[model samples]
Target: MAKISLDEMNPAMKSKQEQLLGKFEKESKTRQFDHYLLAQGLYWISIIVALYHFGTSFIGYPATHLHRSLHVAMILFMTFFLYPANKKASRKSIPWYDIVLAIASLAVAAYVWIEYINFINRMGSPNTMDVVMGTILILVVLEASRRISGWPLVILSLIFLLYGLFGRNLPGIFMHRGYDWKALVNHIFINTEGIYGTSVDVAASYIFLFIMFGTVMNKCGMGRFFNDLALAFAGSSKGGPAKVAVIASGFLGSINGSAVANVVTTGAFTIPLMKKTGYSNEFSGAVESSASVGGQLLPPIMGAAAFIMAEMLGVKYSSIVVSAAIPALLYYLGILVQVQLRASKLNLEGLPKDQLPKLKDVMRERGHLLIPIAFLLYMLLFSGATVIFSAFWAIVATIAVSMARKTTRMSIRQILDAFSEGTRAVVSVAVACAVVGIIIGVVSLTGFGLNMANAIIQLGQSNLMLTLFLTMITCMILGMGLPSIPAYLITATMAAPALVKLGIPPLAAHMFVFYFAMFANITPPVALASFAAAGLSGGDPMKTGIQSVKLSLAGFIVPYMFIYNSALLLIDVTPLVALRVAITAILGVLLIGMATEGYLFKDMVWPVRIAAFLGALLLISANVVQDIIGFSLAVLVVLFQFYWKHKKQIA
Candidate 1:
C-alpha cells in the first residue's frame, strides 16, 4: 500500500485538522484522505447531519422558497468548489461522474424548491416535471449515498422502493396496495414522509449541531484531555495502558462517532504498551476492539444511534440519555471489571507516573471546555431546550470556553471552518439516512413490515428464545456490512415489529436490535474494529476479531438480560426493585465472567467450571428460581475455591 509519513497527511484531513486547530494551534499530524480516510469522512458525515439539524429541528424551520434557493446554491458550491479544492481532499479532484451527479442533484433540489413554491401558489395535482424530478431526486440521493458510503444501504433502499411499487403482488400476509410514481414522489418530496422525514430532519438539525459541538471540542483538545485524564487515573494500575486506551477510546468514540478514528488515535499508544507489558498481540488488539465498540453505547453523545432512537421513539433526546444512563454505565463497568480481572490474574502493572501526564495539570489546563457538555445536559433537562438548540449553543460554548484560555482560542477562520466541515461531515450520514428512508417508506407503504413481523412470530411458534435468537442473527448480519446507526435504523423499521408482535415493548425491542448491531463490530468475519486493532497489534486479524467477540461476551449476553429483565434498561424501575435488579445484574455479570474466564476464588476445576457456567446462565436470566439455583451454585463454587486456595497456601 502507498504510505505517507505521520507528518504528511492528505490534503482533506490536513484541512480538517487545520479547521479544528483554530487560531492558537501547536503541531499536528498532516493526514491525507486516502481511500480509508475518505470512507472515514463518510461515516463522520452521518454524524454531522445529526449535529446540523439541531436548533431548527424543534423550533421549526420552514422550507421557505428563499431558504430552498439558498440551500441549493450552497449544495452546489460545496460539491464543486469546497469539496474539490481542499488539499487533503479525496482523489485530489472530484471524479467526473460525481461532479455530474452533484450538479444533477443540485438541479433536483432546486426543482423541488420551485415546485413546492408553485404548489403553494396554486392548488393542483403534481405536474409531470414535479413527479419526474421527485423520483430522480430519490434515485440521485440513493446513488450519491452509495458512492460515498456503500451499496448495502442503497440496495436496501431500492428494495423498499420496489416494494412500494409491487406490494400488491406479494402473497397474502405480505401485501399492500403498492404506490406508483406520482404518489411515491409526492410522498417522498412534497410531504416530509419519505426522504425529508424524521431521519433527515434529525440529521439536519440537532444531530449536526451536536457533531459541530464535538468538532469544536476536538479543537479545544477533548481527545487529548481525555487521553491524559485516563493516563493519569489508570496508567499506574495493572494493564493500565489498555485501560487508558479503553477509557480514552470510549470518550473519543462518543464524540468522534467513528471506530476507525478511535483506534488510530489511541491504539497507536496502547497497542505497543500492551505488547510491552506482555499482553498477547491478539488479546491487546481484542481489548482495543472491545473498548472502541463499547464507546458508542457511552453517552452524552451515545453514538448517532441514540438521536435516531429519540427520533424513532418521538421523544426528546434528553429522555434517551437519561434512560440510557444506567445501561451505558453498566456497559463500561462490565468492560472495566473484565479488564481489571484480567490484569489481576496476570499481574500486569501500569505505566510509570513520570511517563504519564499529571491528571491535575491536564484538567487545570482544559477543564473549562467541559462546560459545554455540562451546559448541554442542563439545557436538555432543566431548560427544556430542544436537543438542537442545546447543541447550537453548546457549539457556541465550546468555542467560547476554548477562547477563555489563550492556548485554546479559535480564530474566526477556525470557527467558520468548523461550521463548513461540520456541514460537509453530514453529507454521507444525511444521504445514508435519506436512502434508508426508502426502506422505511417501503415497509410502511407495502405492509411488508407487518407481514415480516407476522412471519417471525409464526416461525417462533410462540417460543420467545427462538424468536430472539433469530432476531439476533438477523441484526448481526445486517450490521456486519453497515454502520450501526443505519443498521439500527433498518432493523428498528423492519425487525422491530417482530418483537413488538411477540409482546415486547417498543423500547426493549429497539434496544435489543441496537445491541446486536453494535456487537457486529466485534463479530467475525467482518469485524472492522478488530481488524483495525489487529493492524496495529501485528496480530492475526481474524484471530483478533474472534477473541474480541469472546472478550466482549457481554455484547451477546446483555441484550438477552435486558429482554428478560427490562429493569436493566430502566424499563419499570421502582426504586426498591431497581436497587435489587442492579445488585443481581452485577453478580450475574461476575458469574458469567468467571464462567468465561474459568477462574474464581482459586483456579476453577473443570467440574466447578461447569457449575459456574450454570450459575452464570441462571442468574443472568434473573428469574427467581434460576436466581436461587445460581446463588447456590455460585456459593458452592466460591467455598470450594476458598478451601482449595487455603490448602495450596499451606502447602
Candidate 2:
C-alpha cells in the first residue's frame, strides 16, 4: 500500500475551500481589511461585543428588550464593516455610507432604551419618532441580513412583512386584518414579538455565549486535539480516513454549529485521506458532509437550534441535550457501519498503525482539553446551572485549562483573538435569528402559524403518517438556504404544530422537524455541506449530495422511530426500556446500512438486501411482535448468506 500524506491533496485546497465557503455560506465571507484603521475598528468592535456578552453571563442580562436590542445593534454595526455590500466594493476600507449605516444601527437600537418608559407606555400606540426609529431598525436588519446571509433570508423577511401588511385583502384562511405601517412597525420593532422575539433572545444570550465558548476552546487547540484524538482511535480501522472524518467532524461540528465550516475544516484533511485510501471521490465527500451535518444533532453543544428548542419547549436546555444523546449516537453508528462495510466490500485496508497517532500518547499529550467539556456537561446536567452560567464558566474553564501546557496555553492576545473570532463566528447566525423574528412576528400577528398548521393538517387528511411526511417536506423547503437556527424556529412554528395536533408528543414533533431541517444541508440542489465537501474532494457536487442522503438514511428514519416510541427519546421510559430501545435501534441502523451498501458478511444478494431493509424497518417499529419478526428475518438472511457462500465455493 502507498503511504498517504495529509498534504498530498489539491495544492489549491485552501483557495478552493475559501471559494466554496463564500459561495454557500455568505456569512463567512468577510473582508480582511488592508487599511489599519478599519481593521482596528472591526477588531475592537468584535472584542467589545464578545466581552459584553461574557460579562452579561455573570452580571446578568439587562431587561429582555434592552439586551436583545444591544445584541442586534452590535451585530449590525459589525456586519456593515465586515461584509461589503457588493463584491466590487472596497475590501481595504469601509465605505462612507456603510459607516453611516453602522452608527444609525447603533442609534436605532439605543432609541428603545433612551425612551424606555415612553416605549413601554406607548407599546400599543407608538409616537411618530418611535415609528421612524422602528422603520429604520427594520430596514437596517433587513440590509444587514442581506449582506450576511444573502437574498433568501432578506426576501423571506420581506414577504412575511408584506403578508402582515396586505394579508387582509387575500381570500380564505390566509386572510387577516392588515396592519398599517405604524402598527406593523410598532408590533414588530417596538414590541418583543418581532425583531426582538424569542429567536433573538436565544441568540443574544445562550447562542452567542456558546459560540464564544467554542471559539475560545478552538483557540486553545481543541480542534487539533479532536482531530488527533479521532485519528488515534479510528485512523487504523477499516476505511480509517472516512471513519476519522466521522469522529472528528462530529466533535468539531457539534460545537462550531456550521456544516459548511465543518466540512471545509475537517474535509480538507479527511476527504483527501479517504481518496488516497481508495474511497471514491463522491463517497468520500458524502462521508465528510454527512458526518459534519450530524454534528449539529449531537450534544451538549448541539446546534443553535437546540437552544431555541429548549426556549420554545420551556424545558431545561440539559433535557434537550440528554434526549438528543442516543439518537445522535445512533446516527453516527449507522455512518460508521456503512463505512466499514464499504471498506470490506472493496478489500480496502486501514492506514498502517505506524502512520497513525497512538491513542495513549494522544490522551497523554492533550487530554486536558477535555476538562472544559466535562465541566460544561456537569454544570448543565448535574449542577443545574443556567445555560448562560454553564457556558460562561466553560469559557473560563477552557482558558484556565489551556494553561496546563505551554503548547496549548493562550496568551492575552490569543484570548482576545478568540473573543473576536467568537463574535465574528456568530454574525450570520445572529442575523438569521433576528430576521426569523420577522417570520415569527408575522406568524404571531397574522395567526399564520395556526393557518399553516391547519393547511398541513388538511392536506394530510388528518393522517399522522401523512402529516409527518408533509411536515418533513415543509421543513426541508423552509430550511433550504437558511441557517439551522432559523430553519428550526420557522419549521417548529409552522410545521411541528401539525404533528402535535395529530397526537405526537410535542418534543417528538419538534425533534422531527429539527432532524429534517438539519438534513437540508445534505439534500440535493441546495446542499451546502455536500457542495463544500465536493469542492475539497474534487467530486461532483450533486452526486456527493445524493450519496450523503444515502449515507444519512438512518438519520431520516430515527426521527420517525422516536416519534413512534418516545422511549427512543428517553421520554416516559424506564432505564431498562430505554436501553432495550437503544440496542434494537443500533441493530436497526446497522441493518439499514447493510441494505444501503449492498454488502454484509459476504456480498448480499438482492433478496438479502430487501430482507435486510424490511427487517430494519420492523426492528425500528419499537413493537415486540415486529422486533421478533425483524430479528428472525435478520438471522435467516445471515444463514442463507452462509449457505450460498458454501455452495458457490463447492462449485
RMSD of each: 6.3, 1.7
lDDT by residue (tens digit), candidate 2, 439-514: 8988998999889999999999998778888889999989997877888889998998888888888988899999
Q: What are the clashing pairs of model 2?
A: none
Looking at model 2, report the run of 10 residues with the lowest lDDT sum. Answer: 1-10
Q: State TM-scores per candidate.
A: 0.86, 0.97
Query: Over 4 Å off in model 1, which ranges?
Result: 1-60, 64-90, 95-97, 117-125
How well is each residue in 1-651 modelled by candidate 1, as lDDT tens digits? Answer: 221112233465444434323211111122234566655654354344333344455466666433333333333324332233223445433466655766776787666566666854532357777777667777676655555555667777777777778877988787787778777776666555566666665555545666677777876677767877887888778888778878888888887665655665567667777887778899898888788877778777876667778878877676677666666666666666667767777877877767777767777877776788888779877997766666677777788888887666788767656765666654545556667666666666567778887887788887999999888888888787565566778788778889988888788788888878888877888777787778777899899988888777765777777788887777667888777767777776676667666666556778888887777678766477887888888889888888887986768
lDDT of 2 at 133: 92
Model 1: lDDT to the true structure? 0.69
Cα lDDT, all candidates: 0.69, 0.88
Q: Candidate 2 regions off by >4 Å?
A: 1-11, 648-651
